[model samples]
Target: MDAFYASVELLRYPELRGQPVVIGGGRNATPDTLADGTRRFKRLRDYAGRGVVTTSTYEARALGVFSAMGMMKAAQLAPDAILLPTDFDSYRHYSRLFKEAVATFTTQIENRGIDEIYIDLSDLPGDPAETAARIKQAVRDATALSCSISVAPNKLLAKIGSELDKPDGLTILTAADVPPRIWPLPVRKVNGIGPKATEKLAAIGIETVGDLARADLELLQANFGRTYSAWLVEVAQGVDERPVVVSSEPKSMSRETTFERDLHPRQDRGELSAAFTDLCTRVADDLRRKGYEGRTVGIKLRYNDFSTVTRDLTVPLPTADAAEIRRAATECLKRVPLDRRLRLLGVRVTALLPAGSYIAEPQSVQGELPFAPD
Candidate 1:
């Protein structure tokens, strides 16, 4: 999927084609009907909340706006950009359509969230390029959207190749292409190498994939520890042996909201409590819908400074009950120091088990008997 959310929005408002458009506003930003019956959209300049960019069109990207950027700051960059609220239902609908379309060709697919997937095409009989083309076409036919496809020997190179080209792109790479193509790229381009690793690599004069590949084994081990160091060397040489997992179980379900304005925990206690309760209710509903119950209930708080904290409490029994979840979340919340205004609040349920499954209590230690044996 290419600029997925924005592209989906384009299907609804084709009139905004080739113009800078952003998605992330609340329901209040929905397009209004004009006297002439034309839809008038809210502009980024007119946005007044603390909402962040969920996605933006390539046209918006041209003006230096990107996803996860604050809407207020993005407005300064592309003030005239059209703003639209997120429609996750439509996004999920297209996600299912595209995945189902691809499944018709091959079932060995690893879903990487909603917009991306990894399909094992090694068993398929055809040229890799042709197979990629077919998959791309199938996706487009299913959803009326364009997606970039990259076919490489393994997941690492394939992921890198996928981003080499933009909207509606097809890229093919092999192990032979690693030295010439992958080595010259920055170390950060590797799948597992994140900001902290990138900074560490830079400090040690290992900025590019080539640099990492040629770095001394001893130097890497001394810096990144034995396990990660060895893994880093193998990945730099394009040696990813991990197989694509075809399926996975859900580990947790959660609901969260970022405030339009920072809300004080004490001053805005009523509003904060309402939002917290709503999040827990939503999480409970999600658990029941998905047929799971969780033993660990948690709360996440993000202060106005962008710092975040999370606390979790494990209960004796797993539950999908809204009141139980809320109670657990409230207990976790009590552990956090709310000295600053909160920008975001979230509730999460983890340590999941199938709903209605038998749960046995832990055996009590003999020496640690009730009342310490008096």
Candidate 2:
């Protein structure tokens, strides 16, 4: 899963293997050539619109290209970098291969994303460290891909442990190993800490884990609200007891888009309807690809000022067709106030069950094909 999308591009076009490659918007970008034989340099911020960097190769990273950065900003950093489109279907195939490889050792596998996983080694062979090494080796042998394995007393340390090394990393931590290794890092490195928490921690001189460890729980509670404050303290002390969850289920599937300008549904009925249909098709495609079916079809609307609302309808049967989903969602849309100017619109399908899991009723609407949306 290393530089996943870009790596796949490299495999497809072996010529790009050693170059600094980036995968983002569909087109491959290079320096703009002028008639005079001079090339123009581009900055990522200088590029247009909503695209985000999906992944970039290590060489591209050295040029300040990284994932989730704005595509335009990345173009500015490495304009001559080879750009490729994201091939998620191919990525998913590799994901299944790697997961199936790891599953050979233990069923206690947790997928973090397309690139990472957590394997519970305590229940497996030899020392946990030795077991981790073997697992890493086995994965490489199976897929020709290297992976980092973190073996720890618990999930928290293991999560951080897996990341300490990159490309191929292995870290082992015990309950007693927290302070020296984990404390010096920024509080932001802790799983739940986000931009807001880091800013708050910085305000109170709690920039590092050590500083947070010395913080008063009550003061943190006052700042972060009770639930999050308690979690912060536990993180500081490496007190995570959360079990490594073996099975992961998709809770919902959704699609949303932001428009260039606010649009009132009543004022722009044609445009809004088209966008809604687009979202439904995308979500339905996702459901089919993931082998999932949803009992509920829902719509979400974010007004011009960003206030949001959602409505849903429960269908008698789960489906993965775009037209059926769009029809169901349109019914849900009737419950929303269309007069409000909208900034965003989303469609979601939830209450999911694995595809083919349901038994159809014998008589009512038996095997009826879903009607196509207009």
Candidate 3:
């Protein structure tokens, strides 16, 4: 999908193309503290108290700014860097276009997110690298956008390989190619490796992938525990065998909102319930739009302290009704102790099946309410 959100914005406003542009915040304000070490950040206008940076353009990246940086700090770095509000619906439409374009090359496409994808070109025509180039060309020809691609035997290296080039790139690596290419890079380059893990690895002088490859597995296991230690070693050695999962199913569907201020349930029941109902409606809309009906309905709450909790229920039948989702969510909420103030609230649906699959057994449940579109 390329620089999806930003690219789509660029297409709409061609004047902003090649300029540093950012998408976040209201009309005239920006966020303040974006980094407190690592990548966690907050916005300036949001300082008192805001939003997260969904995505930023390449020009913004040159100013030590990036997606998720606090809006205020981003303002300081690139104040005049055009600020635009996020339009997720527009981005989703573009996502479908690019995804369909890639499917023309291979059905082994794995949707990474609204912006990225992993296409397995192993069984496609011509050489793998050539096929990668062709896929890149096709995406540009179809969407008027460019993307980076990596072709390897498996996903681990392939995911990493795709990012080696920028904007429009094509990089290829095989099992035999590791030392010169993968070793010198920072451990953070590994997709799953986070700042915490990188810091832990650095404490032991394991900076590069090569260093990790040579480090004692017993020592790594001692520090990182069993699963992560083994995964690190395999990634370091380019031994990933995970296949490209072609059938991209929704793992979960959710909707969340950040408040202007932390709200207490008892103190602000009316406002809170209104927000909750809206969230449930959005989640249900997502479920119906995706042609899925989920049995598990859950609620997620983030407290003022920033701690989070989730409660869920598996119903007897799958549904995509807003009121039904809200009832299940409210029932789940009772299980959670609402002693603290809440900064965010969310509703989720999981355990999904195709909506049509549940049509034959329409059993009615007593005491359950029905949802109507608002």
Which candidate has the top score in lDDT?
1
Clashes of each: 0, 8, 10
Question: How big is the RMSD of model 1?
Answer: 5.1
Ranking by lDDT: 1, 3, 2
The 10-residue segment with the lowest total lDDT in model 1:
365-374
Q: Give the TM-score of candidate 2.
A: 0.81
- Regions of candidate 2 where Cα sits further than 4 Å from its true position: 27-47, 257-279, 301-309, 333-345, 356-374
Q: Which candidate, 1 or 3, would have the higher lDDT against the true structure?
A: 1
Per-candidate Cα lDDT values, in order, are 0.91, 0.80, 0.81
lDDT per residue for candidate 3 within 106-172, as digits (tens), equals 7777777887877776666678877778878888887888888887888888778876777798888
Better of 1 and 3 by TM-score: 1
Local distance difference test, candidate 2? 0.80
Question: Candidate 2, residues 107-140: lDDT per residue as tens digits?
Answer: 9877777777766666675787777788788877
Best of the two (2, 3) by TM-score:
3
**How high is each candidate's TM-score?**
0.88, 0.81, 0.86
The positional error of residue 71 in candidate 2, measured at the CA in angstroms, is 1.8
lDDT score for candidate 1 against the true structure: 0.91
